[model samples]
Target: MQAIIFVRLFRLLLGRQGPLLLSLLLWTALGI
Candidate 1:
């Protein structure tokens, strides 16, 4: 489903930026 595709995309991003991107995402979530 869509969730599976999202997870795959997230894993691909994590493989690239990893910590920086993760922190940015967390901060954005907290900000929201």
Candidate 2:
């Protein structure tokens, strides 16, 4: 399902930026 694709994307992001980028994205979304 498309949900799995999102999980993969998150894992890829974790590999690249470790966890800060994830929090940054979440914060930006919450702010908007």
- In model 1, how many backbone clashes occur? 0
**CA-lDDT, candidates in order:** 0.82, 0.80
Question: Which number leads on TM-score?
Answer: 1
Give the Å shift of residue 27 in candidate 2: 10
lDDT of 1 by residue, 1-32 (tens): 99789768888979967888778878986996
Candidate 2 residue runs with Cα over 4 Å from true position: 16-32
Name the weakest run of 10 consecutive residues (lDDT summed) in model 1: 16-25
The residue pairs in collision within model 1 are: none
Q: What TM-score would you give candidate 1 relative to the actual structure? A: 0.55
Return the lDDT, model 2, position 4.
86
What number of clashing residue pairs does each candidate have, in the order they appear? 0, 0
Regions of model 1 farther than 4 Å from truth:
1-5
